[model samples]
Target: MSIISLDSVCKSFGALKVADAITFEVREGEALGIIGPNGAGKSTLFNLITGNIAADSGTVHFLGEDVTRQSAMQRCLNGIGRSFQIPQPFGKMTVFENLLVAGSFGQGKSERAVEQAAADILDRTGLIGRANTVADSLSLLERKRLELARALATAPRLLLLDEIAGGLTEGECSQLVGTIKDIHATGTTIIWIEHVLHALTSVVERLLVLDFGKVIAVGEPAGIMARPQVREIYLGIEV
Candidate 1:
């Protein structure tokens, strides 16, 4: 079943069209990878779906309900959780506090429930040791994990991840892949936009390639990656 669907969605900024009649469906419990070169409007697409920006036309459906006009917070509360490409934890807050806020606000849980959720998220994201540490003092990888953990604290049915593997070492990326796989195992639907192809491919069974706000390819990961157009345009390799 499709948990999220975009139909003929269009968005523009001034004269530049960021998304053009975009359409796709993300199945419940599916992990999808999105890849494109810079300026491909990948993040714009994420914003559109999550209601950070409204579409100029078309409709977005979440869980069989039309949500094209929903606010970002409404969509978030309705089960859309996302992590930005940049980790933006509250600098003065502790890692546990960060998750506490997300869980409390994002899920609208009780204080006790939020605290329990935050603790579990810390463990899952491998941030248990840093739970009491201030967010600003954490290393880059820890920040990324916290970003992911905060999103998980929302208890979303559909998680949108934007470039979470951007600045990790090879080993660190591998570890993140493992963490993501574990999350997927819990039946959370995921749509991840990433430049680190190996890490993205490790967790997503299907792939979508976008360029100039339009989908250029969609298929199984290996087949999509092997396509000449995808290789040339996004992968920067001749096939």
Candidate 2:
């Protein structure tokens, strides 16, 4: 069964329809990449799934349970986690401290649990040596790693990644892609929203193309890119 499912979902903000009768599914351990134009409503779709905003219509099912009305915190507790487009680590805190806070606050873990979880996540995200470094003192790449580590501290089954590779050097993007691949290899399902086509293509087996609040294509990475509509809407600008 699919780990996550959205059926005929619809959401509108005033006259703007951000998601219009959208439908898709993410299978267990599947890495699904989402691409779209700047205003294609990709982030809005993420918000609807995570309960940042209520959908006007349709149902959202996560791990086979209806979560259309679940609060964001509830979703997190229920195994939904996300990293934002912008990294928001606690500047004054060390990388370890930031992750500890996520485990304690977001997952309600005990002190020992938080510490252990944070340590494990830091190792998994390749930030072990820099665990004591102040978050704000890190470079942009390290900051992004901290974001992923913080989300990992929550112990999610399915992770929603919003433009995690938006702004990074080529090498940094490649490194992040490998880290994300490792995370998925450990059985965490990932849905990544990324403008960097090459990075997404390297990590994800399946792809979904969103445009103007609708799913224009869903298939293999190359197939989606080959679609005329998708190319005209997103890939054109990319090339």
Candidate 3:
């Protein structure tokens, strides 16, 4: 089943059109990669779907229902969990506490349920060993894991990953990709917006190329990278 769908969605900031008639669907258990130059509306599209920013026009649907009018919290509870481009964790909170908060607030589960959920999420995101570590004291990689762990605490069927691999070393990127692949193997659908083409190509089967706030190409990863238009936009940046 298609878990999420966007039809003729449009959003703008003053004169800049962020998402221009954007339309796409994410099937259950599929990982989709979105690539484009900086400011190509990738993050904005995620915001539209997650209700962080409302679209000026068109529809946002989830699990076959129109959720265009839903608020961010509503969307989170409705199986849409997103990790931001920048890690957003409470500096003073322990890694475990952050996930517990997400489980209780975002999922509306009981304290015991939240505790179990947080533990499971930490295990899945490879943060169990550092569960008691304060968020501000963690390294960049651990911080990223906590970001994903917090999202997983919501038990989302569809996960939106925004630049989670950016600013990481090649080895670090490989480890993160492996972790993400493991998560996808367990059946969570993923929509990843990343500038690291190699990391994205390694994990995603299908690719969507956004340019100037529009989808220019959508196909198999290698085929999309080979497209002349995609090459032109990235200016020969190897994928």
Candidate 4:
């Protein structure tokens, strides 16, 4: 079953088309990875799906309903949650406080109503020890974990992660991937965009390649990476 579907979705900024009649589907409980060069419109795709940017044309359907016209918060409360490429936690809030805000507002519930769930998310994302610390003081890796935790707090059925592993050390990336794998184990559908090939490939069942705002390939990771065009365009290596 497809959790989300983009049917010929299109978006543009003035003369530049960021998403050009791009179509794809993410299956329920599946992990999909997206890769491309710096200007491939990877994050723009995320914005389209999350309703952060309205498409110029086409439709976005989530779990069988057309959500293209829905607001980002509306889509979020309807089981679509995401993390930005840059971690955007509330600087003055405590680590746990950040989750509470995400959980309460995201779920449209009272903060007290989501307390336990927020605490559980902290533990799962490996932030239990730092729960009381202020968000502004967290290390890069810790902030990334908090970002993931904030998304999880929304209790999304489909999670969109954008370059969450970009700045981490190898060991840090592995540890974060471990937590992400555990999240996937629980059957949450995920579409992740990452520049870290090894970490991205480790968790995603399939890969989607984009170029200049268009989908160029979508297949098993190994097969997609082995394509001559993908190699030359994405890896800058001619096979």
State in Å the error of residue 67, model 3: 0.4
Candidate 2: stretches off by over 4 Å: 133-138, 237-239
Best by lDDT: 4
Residues 1-239 of candidate 3 have per-residue lDDT tens digits of 89998999999899999999998888889999998888889999899989999999999889999999999999999989999888889899999999888888888888687897689778867789999988999988888888888888888889999999888888878888998998899899999998888898889989999988898988899888777878988747554
Give the alpha carbon lDDT tens digit for every residue of 1-239 in model 2. 79999999999999999999999999999999998888999989989988989999999999999999999999999999888777888999999999888898788778786798789889978899999999999987788888788888888899989887877888878888888998899999999999888999998999998988999989999888887888887876655
> In candidate 2, how many Å is residue 13 off?
1.5
Candidate scoring better on TM-score of 2 and 3: 3
In model 3, residue pairs whose N, Cα or C atoms come closer than 3 Å (at least 3 residues apart or on different chains), thus clashing, are none
lDDT tens digits, residue span 1-239, model 4:
89999999999899998899899999999999999999899999999999999999999999999999999989999999999888888999999999999999999999889999999999988899999999999998788888899999999999999999988888888988998999999999999999899999999999999999999999999999999999989998442
User: Candidate 4 deviates by what RMSD?
Assistant: 1.6
TM-score of each: 0.96, 0.92, 0.94, 0.96
Pairwise TM-score winner, candidates 3 and 4: 4
Lowest-lDDT window of 10 residues in candidate 1?
230-239
- lDDT, candidate 3, residue 28? 88
Candidate 3: worst-modelled 10 consecutive residues by lDDT = 230-239
> Which of 1 and 2 is the better model by TM-score?
1
Q: Which run of 10 residues does model 2 get worst, by summed lDDT?
A: 230-239
